[model samples]
Target: MNINKLIRIFFLLIISSIEIGQSLVPVERHGHSAVLVDKKLYFFGGESVFGKLKNSIHLDQILYIDLSKPFNTANPPFEEVINAPMPFGSSYATAFLSPQKKNIIYLFGGIMWDVNANVDKFKSILYSYNVETNEWIPPATTGIAPEKRREINGVINNETGKFYAFSGLDTNAQNVVTTFNDMNILDINSLTWSKGSITNAPLPRVDYTATLLSNGIIVFIGGRETNNLVSVDINQLPLYDTKVDRWSTMTARGVTLENRNSHSAILTSDEKIIVFGGNKDDIATPVLNPLAVLNTKVVPYEWSVPTPAPPLPLTTNLHSATLVENYMFINFGQVHPKNDSLLQKPFFYILDVRNFTWVEKFEPEQLSQSPNGTTTVNTSSTNSPGLGVTTPDNGKQIGIIIGAVGISVGVIAVAGLLGYKYYKKQKYTRAIPTAGSPTI
Candidate 1:
């Protein structure tokens, strides 16, 4: 080959390497919902192109995938728990199991109308599903019934059995849905409601955040009104206190977090709300914010340092980020320069919160196998298709029940390899770099 051609080929090779290293993978569909039950993660209904909500998990009317089994894996075509239907067969409702009340998972108001402004018509109703009884109880009308709301954010303070519902859009007389500032606290035990006209509330916004800190205070942030579904910054907005049901203008310590919506927040083992990316307002889509992390009490909100970790590999995407135990799992989301309307199908990435690092891409099969024993039959079977049907689990499916924990072992392994490579590369590169001697 000609000398010039050889040099050109070498440069091309380097470029190809860079591109390959940066390639993003295709995950699952958009518009899906997820909840963490008994350490395992269960994803439910999502909107499809046909515009019909899908219950792909259920064989008949029930959701098909419980995903709490030990043998579950992402290898492909794995068995999902085809048992049990969601309380009302609803989607887009903020869903989560109460940490203190294992028997129930609380799903509060949600709808699919406005991406930013409130669409006047939305269901104010919220319900809870009892995993043990397989029953759905609507919020009591006189007791804890939420003020009629849709698309509002809900957070449960398990310690106090209080579910705090805040900042959503309401319909005007002409039937126009606009942003609202109403804050209603619902008691899970008493099924009672407390409507507090909170003072100095964050401006009327939707898609904003209200997270329950380990200290038992509520941190409110990122949403939109006439604007878009993005908070200017987690730092810009003040965090709220649920204990007293009050608002404060203070911030957290350390690195200020990026404003995000459609993103998930998890309470880390060490007590921090590790935030991942969501859609950015400047753009019409979701993107990963590598610089997202929050730690501290809420009253006088302070900023904390974000882990100098890898960015969400792509932009203009939103995924269901679920925290199982200490591990943070981000499920199938989209990427866009392509626009939010076009997101990749669902897949997942995990972060080992204890170690403060992001995990490499792996399917469900890569996780640890769950412990095997007699299936707990205390669970009543209803529309749930396939429960208590334990054949010989492949060990992979059962691992999911063990939760994001299996990934912890993998994190250790990956860390060892990375450390070894870094040490060797630094030593070898250092030994080779003597510019004065190499000049010959």
Candidate 2:
């Protein structure tokens, strides 16, 4: 080979290495998890098809957005936090900030692909990520972890320092194994896992919202059961008393909502549980009532639609919603499009829960100096006298669960085979159709 040709080849290799090292922005996806800490949003595993790619793959990078900075929706400022010991790629996982440790976030079960086995499996292990240290911590626990599952919901009791994980679906090799209606408790202080014996638990379900109230009661909202049935009646809300280790139900006295699953719910300072977008049926149709509220402050509880609904950009489901003071930041998910040309993209929107309206940008409340000369967040304007779930005394919001639900065994087997075929070919001409859940 000529000397000039060899030099050109060396330069090309260097360019390829540089491109490989560059971090790319996260793509639009569903069935992921997110948690907020110190005004920053950290995102984890979800499935998305890469640019011009035929099939979807589990995202492996950890992406986050700094809320303090200004950026456009078309191009948000998302930075990737790369770690060598990071967890494997998975979907339908749930995550929450530690109640005992403000800087740490905990991730629970989800569906992970087993490369060696060439099949999908549940992630049974628990993992923690430290935001301050920018590293993933090896989970050390004394007791047996919860059974392998996905689409499970959990909430942390700020007073007890215990995380209560609820119902989820378990599958193996595209076959439905079990749909659990059990509870597993993890003591955040000791990191010990134990079974929760609660009376009158509801049926096996997935993709629900578990909101921990200030009074130690966890409210379970809409989700889909094993038989593809959804809890649509706003009149009935499942209530679990973490203090008593018992379960009960409450009936609200106002407007009812449509059947929905994979929705996001946030508790306002006024004791209102605001529910956002979700799928309405087994076919994965977007719910008609995109936003509604359940006022826990009122006796018997009451449901009502906001007098004037906010103009939403799209109908979304399987998205992550993180509450920061009075603003609810809605993250990426599948959008049920009326126009077929509308493509899914990595984007977010802010809903001002104070008045139930959408805002173009988020302006965090300013910090003020106290009489002792210590800086404090000025939340007086956003604060109201009511009993509901908010950032606990430890400064960590209760875990918000958002994910997809598998419909049945036949559907799962078909979807799994289709997915495997796509994986082998590495390309496809059209998007895979999903029924209430992503293709396995």
Candidate 3:
């Protein structure tokens, strides 16, 4: 083999931007949110950094990707922009779209950092976006927003469009500790938010999973407290029914489906809830494993041991996931890399939940893809007043600085060379509307 040819081959070798099984890039931040609307999936702000604590690097821009369209690295579907930016930059904000044709998505208060790195208090701002006009409007009714929530679960009762939120962990007095148990619900049609009846509610947890059952029941899964302890036995998760406004005291016994947080609850089309890849043995350094979820409808006290289910391609936490028609499209998230200081690589995988198969192979050349690289910068900016940007002192690119720079350069260069010719044709040439005349 010629050495020169080898060098050229290396340069041409397109290490894929597509992540098949393991993450191609590390998704550093957690608590970011995603939704599917207009056959397109949209994602909003969340914190991303190389620290145990959440940071103030809030992203104000929205990311929308088409689900119906096939995505390829060689030819990717371009992301479309919607109406206007939200009022402020935020992460872990609670949002759910009204299920009507309007497909209006509502966002309630979570938390945002002012231009300063100091994480701002939970916001009371409530706004909704319309899929049709790409417009935002405040609902007619106004009242107190949920006390600034952080990890509270976001579940829309499929029965009603109302969103059900539960406990989440947040920083208390100092950045040193964890925050806990608060529950709230919002009526989408009226745009009114009110506290849910709290009785035997589970202790405050940050990363719990909630599954709205078909039998008009809301099942709350494993979520731990601020102290990182399970208030209930690891073997059982506290259950609640929003419809009856009562608790299912039956500790789902026997099965080791430990009520764990940061796990995924994907309700399958066949009406079975599939819980996958969450830390169980420990929470501090979560050990992610796949567990099967049984119907266990209404029989609140019975706990069935989860048959060791098929394994996911990778261990992921803080990654974004959504259920498409036949598959679950999980986006990039962080893995505890051996080297903590350095960023983890981000990657995505498509799970065929129906067949219980995690795709290890795909038409790599044809799969939809993007380069989602992560870097941290202090986004503490005072450009505006109270609503300021966090300008990172250490300069960084959160994702891509995508804009018109490339197009502008190309257009300007071409225009300069063709300027004289165009001018000459206009000034010296006679105007004629001939049948075959060139348009330009």
Candidate 4:
């Protein structure tokens, strides 16, 4: 090919290569927790779609997103947990890694869907799944525990070996729901529950964040305070002093966030909490500065909203987020990109927390359904389809896509080089001197 033609082909190849390498996969979901264990991200149960639709279902599969995978690949990065005890898929449940036990994840109460009753049910069961042993065990506890609740969050105080739970929604036998503005603690060692002594508590709230700071202080952030379900001021930075057993609102300086609930936040290595992707005015709005950072290491706690913040992969709420290494992996939230409608697709995105830039978006593979209209993973048993009845190999399709993209780019690169070489040789031959020509 001529030099001009070669140049044109080279530019096209470069563009295609870049585009392929920059795509992201976001898992469509909400009300799920993305737990980080070393390099792997473990995503537990969550609500896939919300509304009165009888077909709307809760996601029960325990999915693990391998963050180690190259970000350029546009494929389902999620894998269902295999040979593990799966919970009866739930949403709004709190999950935390056991500080004392290696690879143990403790899951607390959440809301589950009961098809028979046609209502969301609150659960009080606490189960522990050991990632190392691939076993699930129910720990027996003593003392008075909180009633079946949902929309709460907690943190484990490694020093005391205790798990502290904050306010959540309480429902009665008649299905009457009320938000409880109380605190509860579970002893990790004894698996015992007890009431916590907290004064001046915030109003009954749900879907808030409980971040354990470096100093062992659990900072409670935005939620739907009161049964009215309105967003409270971001300035009300409530701090739970586990040591003093007292709750006090801290003075926050700098840019305050818009009131929101069902959002997700992560405690950074610098002792700052980065909050993102929540509802404003009860619905997810497409807006800049959906992200905020709280500098908990400093006195009077300063809140800084990053100027020119990166846009979220989507405007969403009721999502779960956790920090792993330098990147924050946020998966599945309720997307409300339009005013007339909302969707509960399991999509997720990753953010480079260092610069607050979005790294990529990922989408999980479309789950296959069994004949009974239940989702099945890896051809598991036909019994009530819980989070993955069977361990299905989900990464094969993604690997093929990645390999194809890589090969396409490679072939294009080689062709361009060859074209250039051929053009250079043709030009040299045309300029060569004949046998009798002067070698000037």
Candidate 5:
């Protein structure tokens, strides 16, 4: 082919090779905590890339996005709230919105760097932020706080104004000290910390999700022990009764899920626990089936895989999943922990749990309303729901395609001009005769 044609083809190929990365551009973070308050979504500390450093560093600032506003997925409008009274950078922390005080959010334990000692330490302190004022309240405590730990799991009993913390990984300067199966209860009303019963508690585990059901029972699923080994069976899950301060186990029936850690789980208004994305054998190997549903309304809790599951090869771990109405928002995590190229891609996904479909954008107003005033959803096909992949706004894609074509045209024009000049020079050289030959 001609040089100009080859140039156009080469540029087009280059454009085609570029992967369409995530439309959302929140800072790449995992092991962070996210909570939905009113129409606002706020996220706290997590492990993130810092400058030229190859290793991930903990973040201290809090960032948020308003769900009421329309935003382009390619460039989400996220506002960062820095300069707050953040004591330290942290990761694998737990955060929940206070039920009594709707405007206040409580942040719990996580791993933070001890700047003075130049070592990693588990945070046992509690920090509260007032959303209305955008200020942190000074932590005042009357009771003993829990031991410093990270990768802990906790959930709030909204009715009682209590935060129940489960077992967590305890670490010191060098390595993991131990994983505790004990429980800690924090009273939001009194700002006090007290211990819970350890009798019949599940094995010392870390990186699990504790989801509180409507009946006031906390369900613990999929976590690993201190040696990074997962022994919890899906058939028999652990349970904690906050009402009685007791622990027990429940045998589930239905599809089984392999043991996993560092996953995210959220309870729906209808009493369904949606568990998604976790690490399997190791951080490098992610769980094959990233999504599962547990129906708590049934006598024996039933477990089932979502119909038309999320797009295949959806590897995620150490991610944060927050539920807002009928939609679940999964934030950044290690998509492919070892693969740098895949890890660089932004990890943000929205799932319409109403129909178990993946959606590209978030539109809260699109919820259908029934005649009486309740929100209506599609529930006809429970087992065979088709994948509803919401097509993102094509404005950005169209612009990129047009820009690519324009660049290709410019390349072709330059290549054609250069080729023409070279051809003319070659013709002139060929037309010249040798010293011993007749001129052409």
Candidate 6:
């Protein structure tokens, strides 16, 4: 190959590799957690089922992907941390990094299938994993820990190393599933649990995601009440003021988000809550990518439909997403197609929050012909604190970067090749004693 061709081929290979690497992940399942540390993503226990009547399968292996590495699906930079297996296989538990210690991930409360009893068992044990050592530490605690539960959500106060465990579902003796409205804080330093005073808390709920704001506010949205698995109204958003140890509701301004459960909601570094991928009253709503952004900085918080949405290759519920810099990594959700088959894959997707654009890992052959991209929703008031205004029009910046890089590489390659050829030609002419040239 010519020098220019070789250079062009190198850039293409890099782009191709990055595309493939983003898709390399663990087996597809819901109830799993993808915890981000530095540029690495650590994936842990989740459950899947092969047949309708078959027993639910719980995942035990620990897999992680280093985002810094080049994309290689077959030889991906995924490392399976072996040695200590979880005390039991569990799912829908709360996973977060300990604010007090470095390299420690804490997992609390999840459900496990009891094969012998043919029932689901809830776990309340607190397990900590040392990310640096790849070891599991089951920490014993004092005070009253919350009841055994699953599908619960929690957030850590990085400043105090205190983790707040929120409401979740539990099974009663009669095989009845129950939920809690209880709130408790686990102090990583003391290894103790203490109940917190929650005033005007919402009803017993599960499958909701919570985001902690810099101002010590915890916003909980889109979960099912124990009585009904149906969607909840968006008007009443629950905001917990950690400073006062109380919970209150806020009337959402502007557009209301679609009522959803089993969705992924994350607080971006820019202080906006980005919610994506969930079931709207049991129907998959994948078309809602960029799903919604709530500007929490403003009082009487308002919700806006995101611009430059992603392509919905499939409808998903029960997925998890975490934010890292300008990129949000989402993975492992239940896909419900029109054929009525429930599917889960280990693939994932990425959203560039800076521009509200999407990065897809997998594109099925039978994608819906839905219109792509989001229309401009009502804009937040300029008075809203720290609102970084961006538009769908600016989304082209990402595409431009990729195109520019590829073009730049080609131009440099061509220029270098031409320079090399010209030098060679001049040297050759000189060596041939052209005109008054002297022979050595």
Q: Against the true structure, whose TM-score is highest? A: 2
Better of 3 and 4 by lDDT: 4
- Superposed by TM-score, candidate 3 places the C-alpha of residue 246 at a distance from the truth, in angstroms, of 1.4
Q: Give the total clashing residue pairs for model 2.
A: 0
For model 1, the superposed segments whose C-alpha errors exceed 4 Å read: 1-32, 50-84, 87-89, 98-101, 112-124, 170-175, 226-230, 252-258, 283-288, 297-312, 315-318, 339-344, 360-440
Better of 2 and 6 by TM-score: 2
Say which prediction, candidate 5 or candidate 6, comes out ahead on TM-score: 5
Query: 178-231 in candidate 4: lDDT tens per residue?
Result: 767678899988888988765788787887788877566788888877678787
Over the stretch 177-232, how does candidate 1's per-residue lDDT look in tens digits? 66656787776677677785569877766655566665666666565553354455
lDDT string, candidate 2, 1-440, tens digits: 75445545545544443422232466677788887765567788776654322223676567887765445565667877765324466678888777667788888888765423435543456878888786765588988677778886677765678888888887776585777778889998999998876578888788888887778788888888865666544457888888888898898788877868888887776678888888876635787878888888877888888854546657688888877667777888777743333434765877888887887766555444457654444111111112122222222121211111222343455545655665555545345565675775
Pick by TM-score: 4 or 5, better one: 5
Q: TM-score of every model?
A: 0.63, 0.75, 0.65, 0.70, 0.74, 0.71
lDDT of each: 0.52, 0.69, 0.53, 0.67, 0.71, 0.67
lDDT of 1 at 77: 22
lDDT of 5 by residue, 261-374 (tens): 788887776778888988775656777778899999996899998765546436688888877657777877877657766665557677888898887767755544467654
Residues 290-370, candidate 3, lDDT per residue (tens digit)?
445555543543444343245545566655666655556665455544345433443456666556666643221222223
lDDT of 5 at 271: 78
- Kindly provide the TM-score of model 2 when superposed on the true structure, using C-alpha atoms: 0.75
Comparing 2 with 4 on TM-score, the higher-scoring candidate is 2
What overall lDDT, based on C-alpha atoms, would model 1 receive against the true structure? 0.52
Give the clash count for each candidate.
56, 0, 24, 24, 1, 2
Could you arrange the candidates by lDDT from highest to lowest?
5, 2, 4, 6, 3, 1
